[model samples]
Target chain A: MTDPKKTVSVKPDADQALKARNGRNIALALGLVAFVALVFVVTLVRLGANVGNRF
Target chain B: MAKPAVLSPDTPADTVRAARWQDYFQLLKPRVMSLVVFTAATGLVAARTHIHPLLGAVAVLCIAVGAGASGALNMWYDADIDAKMRRTRGRPVPAGLVEGSEAATLGVVLSLLSVLLMGMAINWLAAGLLAFTIVFYAVVYTMWLKRWTAQNIVIGGLAGALPPAIGWAAAAGDAPLNAWLMVLIIFLWTPPHFWALSLYISTDYAKAGVPMLPVVKGAKETRKQILLYSLVFIPVCLAPAATGLGGPLYLAVSALGGLVFLTLAWRVFRSDAGDAADPRVADRALYDVAEAPAAEAAPAVEGKRPPPVGGAKDARNLFAFSILYLFALFAALLAEAMIGIRALELPL
Candidate 1:
């Protein structure tokens, strides 16, 4: 198990592996987009709510 | 659904299928995450602080992700034992849907992400508590105590208990007595809830060589301990109302629910819950196990002596009811706080 070569690497050409890889890529993209959006929105809410109290 | 790549002797070493996204999600232990999210959200709301909904949502997400990270790490570490038991055999790493190294990587990555995001978006105190909870569960509980002591769940429960405290900190910028009261409820509740489960299914732990209370101390002692914990747990359930953490609704739920919980514990104590030989669940198919009448004579699986003619329904009742009772307790507090019900103040 310690040997990296022991566990099979993802066979990207196989149909199931190909589907899984595509699905994972899509999920990663969506998650990254969501994270970016969340950070932007949280920034707006925090800064906007506090803008009036800024010294 | 894709088949999980179970390796047969004939199967080549290098021909495993890629893990699906669902497997990755299962690695998060989403059912447990739901409980964490609910309790944490309730704590934030009960604090009655004027945090922006967005910030509150972010806090809950951070707590959920941190909890999921901890669970993934546990699955990674416990894969060997998990595979041996019927209960946890289907988990991603043990079932071969996800590799142990991948689970560890996901756990580490998510742990960092959740902690960083929490610190950036919420108070550093909340972030710090979340990080501590992850470490406590992953390292202290999973790596050290689980195998070492019968008091595993008792101490390890603090990891589960701290989420509400984290949520309270996120909202109020500090956790106070009332917040810790919430933690104490869960901490006290954990032993009875888990021990009741261990009563019926302890053979699984024994097979896996896990040092569960029942496995280590024997079922009779485990039952006695469960009752003892229940004795303490029920009163603590009522403490929130007296401590002003809960209101009329909370009081009603905790009181009425506490009575039923105690009665179940009493039944579990009086009954021969864990004394009989438990059913060999590993030999039975999942559907067979589900379809078999829990209280009736469970058919022997592969000549394995089934648990005494009638299974221990008292233990099962307490186990099932414990989940609902805890949910009701938290829901009452959340509802009371949200609906603006005043707490019952004593004129001492």
Candidate 2:
């Protein structure tokens, strides 16, 4: 006799849905981080070498 | 083996499938975006202005993103028509990979972000042009011209041609005659390029109720118009060299390539490319963007046409060459500017 709690059955569709959702979330996070890095680099380029030269 | 009790034959679609990030990316029409980026970069480089490299990169990115946004909007709006056509039925929206509302939202958000970023990081002129381009593509071309007129691509080509001018404006804060000359090259190139494609794939356009020249005005007229556009297009290709905008390489490429282009167009003019009442083998070859089973590959694409034995070769060749010709012409210009080759001003 197997314990029911030890062997949980998941719906196939539910499993696929969860996996796809996870993938999208990771991709979105990576995209946001890339956007932030790009903005930072662009800001630095626009500012040139002088940090305190202009207000 | 017993089927799982929880898993039924009829599952709700939302539960069975979820959208991926790549589907969202496909909404942007990356194939078209690539062309926009290339032309915009050429314009930026050809301007001879000293914009910072990072800023220039940002400008090009903004243009590409803006173009992509417009494509998303186009897909969102044209999903129904797209689903009816063989070439476009596999798109994210039409394929049910992504919702139309989601595509619309993505387009709207990206359009705003790209325009605002351009205004903040670059100059307002470039931003203004980018804004206009988005609106023009989404509203004027896609929403209005596409379904209403046989001359749809002729007018819609403006949206595609503006990127070069926008790039020039980004670098120099102004668009001069030379910049618009680049614009002219693409504007003129669009008709023949697309018309050659339409000549062979008129059946698809007809099924979708699209007012393509071949569908509305007949294949012979479409071929004639293609020749007319090519005649005008070739001279404009040569103009860059005479105007001191392009170097000797541009002249050689334009002259040789223009002759070949005209030859192809002439062959299309003489060929019975678009007169088929039935969908030809070329229609399958032309619009086989989807990986459907042998069942859907039947004639007419759900009543879709099958590939014919012969005669679409002329239109197909012209279509292929048009892409190469445009790419090569732009490549020559970019190469000349990158390598510091001097332009040869003709005695005119």
TM-score of chain B of each: 0.90, 0.89
TM-score of each: 0.88, 0.87
- Candidate 1 lands at a TM-score of 0.88
Off by over 4 Å in 1: A1-13, A52-55, B1-16, B280-311
Q: Going through the candidates in order, what is the number of backbone clashes in each?
A: 0, 9
Which window of 10 residues has the lowest lDDT sum in candidate 2 chain A? A4-13
Candidate 2, superposed: residue stretches over 4 Å from native: A1-10, A49-55, B1-16, B277-310
Candidate 2, B187-304: lDDT as tens digits = 9999999988887678889988999999899988998999999999999899998888999899999999999999999998988888874344433545332322343345545334
Listed in order, the DockQ scores are 0.40, 0.41
How accurately is candidate 2 docked according to DockQ?
A: 0.41
List RMSD in Å for every model shown. 5.4, 6.9
Clashing pairs in model 2, backbone N/Cα/C closer than 3 A: B280-B308, B281-B307, B281-B308, B299-B304, B299-B305, B300-B303, B300-B304, B300-B305, B301-B304
Tens digits of per-residue lDDT, candidate 2, A1-55, equal: 9866455356765676677778888998997898789888888887776776865
Inter-residue clash pairs, candidate 1: none
Cα lDDT tens digits, model 1, B1-348, are 334344333335355457778789888889899999999999999898899888999999999999999999998899888877776776777667687888899999999999999999988999999999999999999999998898999999999999999999999999999999999999999999888888777887898888999888888888888889889988888887777788888888999999999999988888888777555443553323333455255555654554442436678778878889999999998998899998775332
